[model samples]
Target: MLTPTTASPRLKLATAPLMLLIGGFVSLQSLINGELASRLGTGLRASVAAAVSSFGSGLVLLTLFVLLHPGSRRQVATLGRRLREGTLPPWMVIGGLAGGLFVASQGITTPTLGVALFIVCVVAGQSVMALVVDHRGWGPSGQTAVSAPRLFGAVLAVAAAVLVGLQAGLDPAGAGLGLLLALLPLVAGAGTSVQQGLNGRVAAQVGPWATTWNNFVVGTTGLLVFWLVTFALPGQLTAPPRDWWLYTGGLFGIAFIALSTVMVRIHGVLVLGLWAVAGQVIAAVVIDLVVAPEQLGVLSFVAAGLTLVGVVGAMTLRARGVR
Candidate 1:
């Protein structure tokens, strides 16, 4: 029942607050994807639908904006031209696959692990990878050394995950499977970290709007193909309940992707990961409480607070330009 609408989306226009708000979207996205996964746990309907909604809605809005702003259209043209001339790395174009991986993994993991734990593990992965990625100068932000403070921050993030796992009281019977499923988001996080860097580079070439549009094109194509393949399996496609909130994932997806495209360029991957994780953990706690208050407890709150502390610690180091 959720089809792409014609209305343009209201984007976060300011560059400064984009990073902060994107955090909110990060948690929101996870919750939405988790619900979508639950609805289609028997099959792939939820993942596919979520992906399509994300890409289709974002593309439609982007197209409208580009048409109205000649400057934006020109930027898209420039990116195309540059790609044709081999000025940009061809790999940059595939950055959207990261989004595909994210939604797909959520479909598999979130229902089991819950959003708070899922996000904590994701932060662990992002913290480690972003440290390496930023340290190696793989992204446009240049090299940031993995100093003591940065290393400590990564340790804290890992600790946060451990705390959540402990609080969940992982059942020994299902521990293996639960841990395995939970780890899937770590893979998603790696994809996202790389995707952030690639999109950042592309943003330099075509501007943020076009960079996000390109991500939608590639990511949506991939998801749509997978969605079609799901029909071949034995499961039935389950439509989500008529709750309007279930359908808002795509909008949040667009917002965060666009925000990350810009944030990676400005703050680098590590900073973005830390800050975004802070947002995700905090938002996730509140969302979980609202969704199923009985499922959460004080330990969840502790995990969230720990994540913020780690993020703030890393941010302080970055602010000081610590070598």
Candidate 2:
């Protein structure tokens, strides 16, 4: 009974909300990863061990999906050809190494730093690098100039991260060092996000399913290699906890990879990344207040509120084409 025009609009209306919902889900899943890392840090396992195991699980899951899904094989082959043709940059593989480092850092430091501080540090690093990445358009998609709105959003996100750090009671000297180390993963994540955005832009040409599978495959392989070289040596890595909850971090990673691809399609990578950071900050605040009241103070809330306002304003400007 529905005409094509009406159906298309209706579909868009339905899909926009769904995309936002998925974004929220991705954020919550990230928070869960933070929690899992904190818990697992108490165990003997190296953070790299958890990261490797999670990536291994994700590789298996994606491989299974590709095998069972009829059209995925063709898509994978086509994507491989595209990569060979140089449509996908070789540097993306480095992004996977970054991912491994991030997981390891989270596992090693999250307990000492707490979720709120960790998220803030990570977001700060990500936003600063994201600005550079987005401005340069260093991914599969051709370059899109960075706009003012995007810059404003990045600043706000950084401010929010700073506020979170201040709440962590870190001495100036120690905070400086922690912030520096945190930037490593943040820069890596920004690269990953750019790649994701580029992938979304080309999704219609190169099947999304195929692209997703290829990323996981490459990322997993890279992480596996890292594990072998750095942590898999005897006495270097600890065994992972046998409990099911420890595995939640890996499950969250799988969900994030898939949902983030969908989000990049609906929201520009910059906006999606900002919102994701916002969500994590919100969760981090709640976690800190409940678990570590010493980290909660007046300045933290004020900075958080200001950062939120800035993010919202930036998003509004973006919607108005003022970016």
Q: Over 4 Å off in model 2, which ranges?
A: 1-45, 83-89, 92-94, 139-141, 164-177, 180-185, 197-205, 229-239, 267-271, 291-303
Error of 2 at 58 (Å): 1.4
TM-scores, one per candidate: 0.83, 0.77
lDDT of 1 by residue, 1-323 (tens): 11113212232224435566788797787787778667754756665666566566767777787889888888889889998999987887898888787877776677767777778777777777767777777676677667766677778877877776665555688777766776777778777777777776787668888887788778888888888887787566565567777767768887777667556555555556666777787787777778866656676677777778887887788678764
RMSD values for the candidates in order, in angstroms, are 7.0, 4.4
The TM-score, computed over Cα atoms with residue i paired to residue i, of candidate 1 is 0.83
- Model 1 spans > 4 angstroms off: 1-19, 163-169, 259-273, 297-302, 319-321
Query: Poorest 10 consecutive residues of model 1 by lDDT?
Result: 1-10
Give the per-residue lDDT of model 2 (tens digit) for 1-323.
Answer: 33323445455456555444443443443444445554444432445555666666767787898999889888887767776998755554344455555666665555555555565566656666666665677554556677777678668767866665565445665876555544544554455555554555455556777766665666667666665665435334334456776566556666766766655555545666667666766676676677676755675676556556766787788779895
In model 2, the worst 10-residue window by lDDT is 1-10
